[model samples]
Target chain A: MSALLLHALGIVLVTAAMTFVTRSAPFVLFGKKRGTPPIVLFLGTYLPPAILAMLVVYGLKDVRLLAYPYGLPELIGVATVVGLHVWKRNYLLSIFVGTAAYMVAVQWVFQGTL
Target chain B: MMKTVRAAFLTTLPVMTGYLAVGVAFGLLLQKSGYGVAWAALSSVLVYAGSMQFVLVGLLADGSGFVAVAMVTLFVNLRHFFYGLSFIDTFRAMGRRRPYMIFALTDETYSILCTAKPPEDVDGKAYFFWIALLDQSYWVAGSIAGSLAGSLIPFDMTGLGFAMTALFLVLLVEQWEAFRTHEPVFVGLASALGAVLVFGRGNLLLPALVTIVVVLLLMKKRLTREAYAPPTPPAPADGPEAGGAP
Candidate 1:
């Protein structure tokens, strides 16, 4: 309707299209083959853990190590997560507690200090 | 089908919590940025990538050029290319659901799909599809709710987004336990940390992923051997038969 909405729609479309391209490129490249290569299979099996590890890092990439709070909240939060997960081995419990710890650390414990 | 959906729902519960928190945050931000429920819903349903949607709100607010938007989107989402590598054959087997399976492969969905195997009696394809669908539905529902509640809500949700980080960490630990060796995990952590140190946070993902692939390629022989190696026999006296058993 309006120019702004039109522009926003264009941005959304482009963003969606580019995102889809990235997600589907691997399939499109390897899909037509009769059998998957051993290398691809190797990557499929092993790459996930590495990717998950990378994602953990990616998630914490924004934490500032040099600043006042100095990434303490994230450290404590992650420690809680790892500790709870290791000790209890409960998925939901670990995530909920870890997240709550993080929220408290940022919201109250380190509030206005960042 | 109902069984598949129920199982998928249970499997995606963690994702549900994380997505709703982050999705509501996204919706709130978009609404605060002058776009309302309709825009929030559209983007959540169409784009569906969590972090990218958050970034999109800023781009929309600034009225950034399509070229710039596209470039930013590509850079932010390049890691997704590798995600599909893990699912190519599995998704191919899904037949008619293959395209949606690919399209809905968000980080959370990908992570859950990587580990959440269906029960023996349940249909694996249906399970996977429901997980993907249910995850997206949570995201969409959260977006709409946030947009609707943004104006009325006057509360602080500063770090609820950490649920996502916690989700990843939990999954990482699970993956660590599932694998026989932790080489891939270490490789990932080292490569990503190296990239962060060298490239800085915003630019680390591509380099980190590239380094990971290269390093894993080099370590292929050892890693594959470890991954596929049969369990060792307790006693050496039975070693010959053990070695030839498979």
Candidate 2:
């Protein structure tokens, strides 16, 4: 779609043109609407979270649990994420801890050297 | 204006890992598919989709016809139509930058705009415009890197695609905490599940979005007038770029 339509030069120019037309110009179509469309407002709020959950599930799709020597890395990471999210209610902390656990698992647990 | 930029930065910072993972994946995939830096920059600049761009690479590989390509691209990117619809009030007043703002509509940019609250001294229009700019900068940078480095980087980079999902996870948790309403969450889940069941995994987002719209319409009576819309004001900031000489 966009890839084929835009080459290096074509991409830059078309993109810039679209932006120029959409944002740089004055109020046009969606602007000054009598009211926010009912459906738009509803979708705006919930779409981020639902799509996000789907993404999480998608990432974990086909992940092999028992194939790992101890299943320690993923187990620790997911548990830590759920735990930290529930415990501290901090998004950043959950990601950090889970990611760190995965790193450690790959580096040490898999090797059984650390 | 500065406050808006600062806020956008703060908000976008939380999603960097997601952006980094997805951006890098797009770049790698683009380069691998014979797209150059120009292509990367162009789409990142124009299309401005976080994950949809990645999917576009496959479409390009298939050699779909121009009309098909455009139609499919538009359909796939139709979620963006909602993005524009929601922010109409804010971007409508951008004066000069309004057009670019509309064109540069990315999910990250929209998220920034959706959550943004103009500070006392800042102009909402300018703030809205700048948020879109900063978000585009990140995408453009990723595109440039992907296209430029396409020739150099080797080995499979498929793992980077996980970034899209990772980011969605981060946002999910963030919004869950910020808002009081939960109906939207239920609707989205039900829709996504419906999409997965109906379209299978290959084309889930569209069905999911459709499901969302249908449910909201069906539940319109119960769900109306509950969500918070940001305040709107019409005035240029007290001269652009505060804190300069008289």
Candidate 3:
């Protein structure tokens, strides 16, 4: 069921506000004069890799290993993305090829009787 | 301004593809859930976080209470708080455009702004603003197209979602190459795997992030010391700023 217009608006607005606040919080809290605390700077300098790694995992969180084709499709898909990116260093090529590979795997190769 | 815009467009060209595909998926899913194109457009225009927008599809479909939805959105977007810390000075320097920069600091944009600098002749504000604007436009255009075409599309989209994962992986690889220290990367991977085993898929992200934080804090002496050390070699003398005009 679709949410009521009012509820949808409220949810969307709240999400927007919360997101805006979080993104701007660092700047707002630190201000321009005092500068960012060293620990905060440390996190700022270093958190990107960790966050990106977490995002990579988060992206594939739903892939099921217990299923018939298992997570092979996912594994292969990731390998293609990683391999192609490592080889080419082209972001667009890697993502397009990796996605195309996954689409083929699930749609045709790993197609389970539904 | 034109030159800066062109360079920004070039810089954001990679994100353009990812946003379009993911945005289409979002629109299709939102339409499938009974919301109209207007709703899809509004959500894309407003919420704007790619992963959170995808999650919002479910939350919207479920007709969840505002409080619950708000909490989930906060949790999903908590990392953004970290993203801003790095850009605080740069964004503050942008004066009038600072607010939009903050609002548009999505994961991909943050990644781009972290490493890419404009050519010496290009205005940094113009470059940064155009990047953010162009990226958002791609999302809006893609989502609107998908919502409009959602009902007419006939093909299976079974594994198309992996584009997002692929995007993240590509970014991870780039970050890995950029960083000299492997501690954060390893900590993130290990923490995520631990979370997967302990919390399973549904509840993994927050715990994984917390674990990374805890471990990073415990090892702060090493990480911070190494991170801020003065450059051993000469800094890149040929950085984009020095590369002059396009």
Candidate that would win on lDDT: 1
Model 1, range A1-114, lDDT digits (tens) per residue? 999889989999999999898899999898778776667767777788998899899889999889879999999999999999999988889999998999899999998854
lDDT of 1 by residue, B209-239 (tens): 9999999999887875735553221111211
**lDDT (Cα, 0-100) at B140 in candidate 2:** 75
* Pairs of residues at least 3 apart in sequence or in different chains that clash in candidate 1: none
Better of 1 and 2 by DockQ: 1
Model 2 interface RMSD, in angstroms? 7.9
Q: Which ten residues in a row have the lowest lDDT in candidate 1 chain A?
A: A34-43
Give lDDT tens digits, candidate 2, residues A1-114.
455454434433433344334332223543556654545554444455444445455455445555655456556666766667767865567676666666666565676422
Best by TM-score: 1
Against the unseen true structure, what C-alpha lDDT does each candidate score?
A: 0.84, 0.57, 0.78
Compute the interface RMSD for each candidate structure.
4.6, 7.9, 5.2
What does candidate 3's lDDT look like per residue over B24-114, in tens digits?
8889888888887998899888888988888888887777888898788888888787778666656766778889989999988886776
**DockQ-sorted candidate list, best first:** 1, 3, 2
lDDT accuracy of residue B3 in candidate 1: 85
Task: Assess the local accuracy of residue B232 in candidate 3 as a C-alpha lDDT between 0 and 100.
Answer: 17
What is every candidate's C-alpha DockQ against the true complex, given to 2 decimals?
A: 0.59, 0.24, 0.52
Q: Could you tell me which 10 consecutive residues in candidate 1 chain B have the lowest summed lDDT?
A: B233-242
Winner of 2 and 3 under DockQ: 3
RMSD in angstroms, all models? Answer: 5.8, 7.4, 4.9
